[model samples]
Target chain A: MQLVTPGIGLLFWMTITFSIVLFLLSKFAWKPILNSIKEREDSINGALSAAEDARKAMDALKSDNQKLLNEARAERDRMLKEASEMKDQIIAKATKDAKEVGDKLITSAKDAIEKEKLNAINELKTQVAVLSVDMAEKILRKKMEDRTQQEAFVNDNLKSITLN
Target chain B: MFSNKYKITKYLIPAFLVVLYVTYAGLKLANAQHEVHTDSTAIVTGTETGATTHSEVSHEESATEHKPEKVDAGKLIMEHIGDSYDWHIVTIGHTHVSIPLPLIIKDDKGLHVFLSNKFHHGHEAYEGYELKEGKLINLSGADFLDLSITKNVFAMFVAVIVLLIIMLSIAGSYKSNALKAPKGIQAFVEPLIIFIRDEVAKPSIGKQYNRFMPFLLTIFFFIFINNIFGLIPLFPGGANVTGNIAVTMVLAAFTFVITMINGNKNYWSHIFMPPGVPGWLLPLMIPIEIIGVLNKPIVLTIRLFANITAGHIIILGFFSLIFIFAEMNTGLGFGVSAFSVAFTTFMSFLELLVAFLQAYVFTLLSAIYFGSAVEEHHHEEHH
Candidate 1:
């Protein structure tokens, strides 16, 4: 019976103490503790999201750098190709001009050689005729008796000329 | 399967009979002891020597009550569990060493205040009042209000003060630290506070959990600290603060009152005219719903009180075994002491777990009630 029974004094005191504890703790202890905990939690969440935003921004910046590098590489390749094409054009033009100049020099040299050969040939023919006439006069003086041979040679030449 | 069933019943029948016989014997002993106490108090007026001589005559089995000083295990166990006017410490021979608490009373004469030690452990009467069966009574047949600080109340005050100091200091730390990382005791208690918020209050009370956090936290720590303190077998701890029916009654009443005050329109409607019920069954269903509403607090009170009281009883019973056997033979007493000590230690450790579990259950159930009371009628939108 005593085990199950509740004393009125204890009950009275319990209610008073419990109510006081609740009221005091709610006012002093729980309010401050819970508010600070909540504030800390919100701040923690804010920091985490801020870090996430920073990481995303960094990723965007890295990609932008990659795109710029790619564009610069493409520009460099295009410039190298243009330079090589211009060098090829300049080399082709020089080779064609050199060939034309060489051809003109060869033609002029051939014409000059032809003129010199013609002049030498005419002079040799006139000198050979004069030497032959001198040899024949010396032989005629030595041999007045050969006048008949000389007159026969001239008559053969005059006959050939009249026919022509 | 039939064979197996028969085999189980072969052992079960005898086990049930043994349990029945033991309970019958216990009840008879308790009845006999109860009569002995009343007879002594009535005739001899609550004296130590008078009660002993009277008990010896009543109980014939204890032929040598005077020489050996018979140990009444039942009485000892009862005394350990029951409320008292003073804080009992120990017993040496006929002398009881205890701390006397204050007694405040209001009678037809006037308000009287004095220390409970003036009664001398119920061995004598003081002034016009007398300590009868661990209770104070007015000898002149006058009614009075007993507003004294009993053993349980003193324990409660101690528990309350300790809770205040620890909690207020922790709250102060929170103010100083602000958003910085927790350290020392702050780090230790922060997780438990968070667990109550996140696991208990949040899930049990939902979005409005913040509105009830203060109440939830107060009750949770109050019950938990008292439960743990009740397990300590020393000064300021041994009193069953949470186990006391009066204390639990008060706690449960708080939950009940809070629920009633906060009950939304949907809650009241569900009680008066429950949804999904046929009009024909309205009369039957409403009464049942109302019963269910009142039943929640009763269940909370009984659950905490019974669990803590039963734990104390079992531990005390195991300890009593040693003395009960010692009355028979010294060697047997020594032999049983080993096992008794071992079992008591094991039960005490188990009680530690029960201590935390009961507190958690009380708080969780309270939060659930609060949650249901404030719950909105979201079912309408689902259709």
Candidate 2:
């Protein structure tokens, strides 16, 4: 019967002792313990999100690098195409200038040859006229042996011609 | 079936070994019991004379008349489970070894404080106050306060010291290794602490769990350690602290006080004028709700006390069967002891499980009560 009954003294002691323990533990122990746990959890979460942000930044940087590389390749291709076009233009201009200079030289050479042929024909005509004049003079001198004979022959021929 | 001779020996060898083991254990137990009986008889006789001489003038003369005979199972079990003025450890051949605690009493005359040994195991009276059936009473039939440190109190002090050491060390680890993971005792206890916090405290106490966490944690560990200690049945153990109604009542009272102190307007309103109930039902519902508040703590008190006490009783009952059978026949007693010991061992293991379970139940229920007290009644917004 006494076992089931509650004693006031025991109750008093229990209340005092339990209250003291609760007060002591709550102040000294529980505060630090719970705070540390929460702190750890917060740090873990921060680290995780920071890592995620870093990964996204890396991805964006990779894409930016890829875009730059593609632009550089396009620029190189355009420069190569322009350089080849300039090379063709320079070669064509050189060829056309050389053809014009060659054609002028040929025309000048033809004109010189035509002028020399005309001069040569003119000299040959002069020389042939001189020779024919000389030959006529000689034949006439031989036929009139003496001046008197020549006069008489002239008179005689004239007279004959008149009489005839 | 092939070889019957070989099969017979195979089963027979293990059976022979088991029989040998049982016999050895039974002999040891019988020897110990014999020693206890002889020792207890001598002490009883010596104390009987001392008590008669000192308390000859007292009214209760038959208080010290108990004698050692064949075992009285009921008396023995009661003595084991009940609180005492001193901590009895063992008896060895007429010598009873016990630790005497201080007995403090407040009466009309004044406060009287002395060692409990002066009463000599409730055999002799010390300064007109004698123990009558485990109660310290005055010979003059006057009322007084007994604030003595009994066996349960002493056990509680030991338990408190152990709790302080374990918890403080764990707290230190948490401080030093703040970012690192828990280790050692911290590793062991952190999970249980988290369990109470997450499962018990958070779910029941909701958002304001932090306020009540300290109280809940204290009660949970205190009850749990004491329960585990009571199951040990050795020195520093077997003090039925949680089994005592007074101890459980105090624990329950703490919960009751906290709940009432922390009770919000919603809590009181719900008790006095319950929402959603008809106006006419107020008269009946109000008192019932009020009783419901008081009943929660009372139930908490009785639940812990009864569960622990009942477990101790069942274990002791199994132990008593051996003596009861021994008195009938020597061989019968020996035969019964085998079963008795087996059953008692099984019960003790079961009690271990029950100890933790009861502690959990008590903490969970207390958390639920605090939850209700601080629960906010949010009005539903009609769509």
Candidate 3:
């Protein structure tokens, strides 16, 4: 069992054997291993491609979202503008309508006041005329009550009439 | 241009071989002194105070006269030359350079240029001695040739060639879809190739990793294949190429060089004057950063060298237990040797994992180093 100084003969043969084995292994074993590596590479490329597509999609989605947001903002702005404009128009229309109605009421009121005043003046004149007539009658009756003055005034008036 | 690149790559294995030769020679030389490893006559009996000494003398020792080596390049190269080495020192000596043809055994040191007057009828042998310097010792340059081509080297070579053939062949298959239904080796190796490209190179080095892919792939395969090759006990596996420190050092050096060359202004700035650091602290930070630059490769070298070396040593040590116990007593030897084999085999099984794990760790670290060097450590680029 003493450890043999590994013989030169042993060394020579071992070299040959391993060389053949390595050569053979290189021929057969390495090819498949490389294929597997290439396969791994292909898979990696595929993964990278997928990742690229995903990133692009994400970017597209983000821009689209921004566009939509901008559109929403614009629509909101337009609506606000329209509401303000409509409010102004409505206010202007209401004010004009109120002025027109006020003018009609004032004209009607002025006519009514003038008609009442004319009626009042006519009625006063009638009353004054009637009172004057009544007063005259009363004065005549009073003069008649004074028979002598009344006869003389009557005779004077008849004489003045005969002469005309 | 291709050839230059190939030339660079050719050195990687040669570098491994060179280290193997050196380690083997060092082991042999240490064996004479009885103390490179743990299983030698110098070690004592028990696992006590002096028990470890006997274990140290188990390595092979060559007969020597202890001469200080002359520092000649030729001599340095000659020392570590492997069994296969046979340099013609003298051509016109009439009988193979005055030295006997096939003069000595692989392990025995023999002179390449034998002088007619020196030995038996125009034959002489090589000489060797330890090269020494002030506080340092190296073998003369002559002995530095591939002295011991261990099994690890063979296995590593085969692993490399095999890896090449497999890769080239599979690459053909991939390009052509050759196998209608490929199985076995193709299946295993192809994935790794792809993994190296997509996983290792791309993420760290970026999409421009194509140019760098081949190197990374080569390194991964080289380390992985050798590690596995080391595991096999019969032939190629025993070389322990990864275990050698010199080999790992060179590998780390390659990384360091590549990283430096590829590094941008950003990388260099971090080393010389780190960014975001206060002006007052720049003096301190700069030195530390400079030190860190050197530390990276050193850490890399030690991590690999130690891990691989540890595995080999442990396995060998386990096997040695049988001899140690048997040497102590006949009964103990019988029982312990049997136990040691089984234990060693189990350890070898575990070593396979370590082999791969270490290779992975080394590769990962190398990749990290590359990444750091190329990384843009400035804020201006962010905008």
Calculate DockQ per candidate and list them.
0.57, 0.45, 0.01
TM agreement with the true structure for every prediction: 0.81, 0.73, 0.47
Residue range A1-164, candidate 1, lDDT tens digits: 76667788888988889999999999999999889999999999999999999999999999888989988998899898888888888888888888788778777777777777777777777777777778877786665567787688788778888964
Comparing candidate 1 with candidate 3, which one achieves the higher lDDT? Answer: 1
Q: Per-residue CA lDDT of candidate 2, range A50-69, in tens?
A: 99999999998999899899
Residue-level error in angstroms, candidate 1, position B291 = 0.6
Top-DockQ structure, candidate number? 1
For model 2, residues B1-383, the per-residue Cα lDDT tens digits are 66985786587667655755765565455444544655533343443353332233221223235324547788888888888888889988567899998989999999999998898877899888998777788999998888988888888888988988888888899999988888998888888888999999999999999898888889999999999999988999898999999999999999999999999998998898787888999999999998899999999999999999999999889888876755543444566676777678768889988988998999999999999999998855232
Writing each residue's lDDT as its tens digit, candidate 1 over B1-383 gives 99996886687657655644664454445445655667544454444444354434544445444344577888887777778889999878668899999999988888889999999878788869999878688899888988998888998999999999999998999999899998888897788789889999999888999988888888999999999899999989988888888899999999999999999998899898787777999999989998999999899989999999999989889888877765543334555666677678779989999998998899999999999999988777322
What local lDDT does model 3 show for residue A55?
95
TM-score of 2: 0.73
Compared with the true structure, what per-residue lDDT tens digits does model 3 show for residues B305-382?
Answer: 667666766766666665555443334445555556656776887887887778777777777778888876546643
Task: Between candidates 1 and 3, name the one with more favorable TM-score.
Answer: 1
Error of 3 at A155 (Å): 96
State what share of the real interface contacts each candidate retains.
Answer: 0.86, 0.63, 0.00
List the candidate 2 regions with Cα displacement exceeding 4 Å: A66-164, B1-68, B329-341, B381-383
- What is chain B's TM-score across the candidates, in the order shown? 0.81, 0.82, 0.61
Sorted by lDDT, highest first, which candidate order results?
1, 2, 3
